[model samples]
Target: MNVYISADMEGISGVVHGAQTEPGAREYDRACALMLGEVNAAVEGALAAGAARVVVNDSHWNMRNLRIEELHPAAELISGSPKPFSMVQGLDASFDAALFVGYHAMSGTSPASIDHTYTDAIHHVWLNGREVGEIGINAAFAGFHGVPVALVTGDQMATAEARALLGEVATVQVKEAYSRSAARCLPVAEARRLVREGARAALAQRRGPLRFDAPYALKVEFVNTGQAEMAALMPGSERLDHRVVQYSHTSYVEVYRAWRVFYNLAGAA
Candidate 1:
């Protein structure tokens, strides 16, 4: 079996503050090291479970957090920005299963470490009528390509969000959040062990993908009217109110792409 992994930074084992996730901050290096450790653990686990190929995507801000040299040699890395599929970039129908590592909860989720969906400008996102965060959006994208999200690793809130959205999937909680920027973290070694075990179990189960119905409706509520106005400029997007923009398509992939456009435009505001 082939496996795909999308790695984010916020819910990384040692990450508790925004500074740690930013490129120039003093703590960023340590954060990246911790992130790499968990990713390597997942890769090792997937390979042990008889996966022939493993693809790792750097699915965080700037999309260049993981160093190829530091990664496990058996896995290929996808790193950069403006990827066509963003977080789930390089993913397609060819893979057997996908994993989300170091994910966080949705925006406005209390006690979720560094919670935010896609971007700070996006306050909330809804597919059809159900609210979702990064886990839901990316998992649905994987489902669109006929791949199940088997494993997710992060803080308590992130794992809970994943289970709630994609039932019974394997999860590893590396920390327990006390606030958006505070958590009771697990030691790096312990967290990596849990992640490795989670990956192995997840691939073994081979859960079904989480798919949504066609004629998908996407609604994005921005943090302000200016962001909403900018998002509404996209073709096929309608202004639902002062802070919400709505877009719909029969294909979920199209809606996903439009979501990227919406946030990029909103960020300009």
Candidate 2:
């Protein structure tokens, strides 16, 4: 099996505050080490389960969080950013299964650690009238290429939302959020054990794409009026109101691409 993993940082065990996830924080180094341990565990578990190849994408902010030098020898890493697909950049039809490691809940989700879809500039993202976060959007992108999101690990809300969106698979809850910036986390060792086992079990199940109906409508709501105005500048997007812009496309890839544009422009504006 060829497996693709999109790894984010906010939901990693022991990560709660902005300081833990972003650069310049005192604990950021320790947080990065924890992230590498969890992700490496997942990679090791996948390889042990008979995977032919495993590709790990450093999908966190700036797209460069994982320590490439310390990554598992059996896995290939795709790090750094500005890729067309963003979080799911290296994804394609060739992979047999997909895993989201250390993903978080969407904006406004209660009791979620460091939760936000992409950036603070955007409020929420809706696809075909259904609200989704980074997890949902990335799962849809993977599905577009005929891949199934087999497992997801993160905080309580993160795992719950994944089960809600992608149906029952395998999940590892590394922490339970007490607030947006606080959580009751598992010890690093226990978190790694859960992730390793979860990945192995998730891959053992049958693999299939999480179907998104064709002719998708991608809508984004920004935090400010100017952001929405800037997003509406995109060719196909229609301004629904002061803060929201909607774009329609028949292809999932096109819809995803438009979504990327909408968020990028909105954030930069």
Candidate 3:
């Protein structure tokens, strides 16, 4: 079976500060190492569980955080930014299952470390009035291509969000957040152990893709009114208020495309 892993950084073991996730910060290098360890653990787990192929996507800030030389030899890495799909860029129907590692919670999540939905531009996202985070959005994108989200690894808040939206998928918590930039983290070794085991079990799950019903309605609440007003300028997107824009699509894929436009516009804020 083919497995896809999308790796972010803020939710990695021991990561709790913005400096650690930024590309040039002194702690950033260490953060990358931690991120790589979790990813390799997931890779090892998926391979051990009999996956024939595995691919890793670097889905954090610039989308190029993973150290290529340190990546598992068993998986190919997709990195770099400006890709149309962003976090779930490489996803398609060919993959059997998708795993999310090092992902954080939504913006404004209480005590969720460094939480934000997709980018720094937004406060949160809503699908059919249901508040959804990055994990949910990416899972839905994968599902649109018929790939089930089988596992997620991050912090306690991340796991809670995943369970709430995606049901009981396997999960491994690297940390428990005390606030946006503080958390009680497991030792590196223990977190890796949990991640590997969780991955192995998650890949064995028989769950199907989680698809949103068609005619998807999306509401994106931007960081400010200017961003919202800018997003509303997009075709078919309507300004709901000073900070939210509403967009509808006949297909999930279309909604996703519009989502990209919406956020790109919002990111200017």
lDDT, each prediction: 0.93, 0.90, 0.89
Which consecutive 10 residues in model 3 have the weakest lDDT in total?
Answer: 205-214
TM-score of each: 0.99, 0.98, 0.97
* Candidate 1 pairs with clashing backbones: none
- Estimate, for each residue in 32-123, the C-alpha lDDT of model 2 and write its tens digit: 88889999999988987789999999988777778788999889999887989888988999999999999999988999998898888878
Q: Pick the candidate with the highest TM-score.
A: 1
lDDT of 3: 0.89
Best by lDDT: 1
Stretches of candidate 3 exceeding 4 Å from the true structure: none
Q: Which ten residues in a row are the worst by lDDT in model 2?
A: 206-215
Candidate 1 lDDT (Cα, 0 to 1): 0.93
lDDT, candidate 1, 167-198, per-residue tens: 99999999999998899999889999999988
Backbone clashes in model 3, listed as residue pairs: none
Better of 1 and 3 by TM-score: 1
**Backbone Cα, N, C clashes tallied per candidate:** 0, 0, 0
RMSD of each: 0.6, 1.0, 1.0
Residue 149 lDDT (model 2): 93
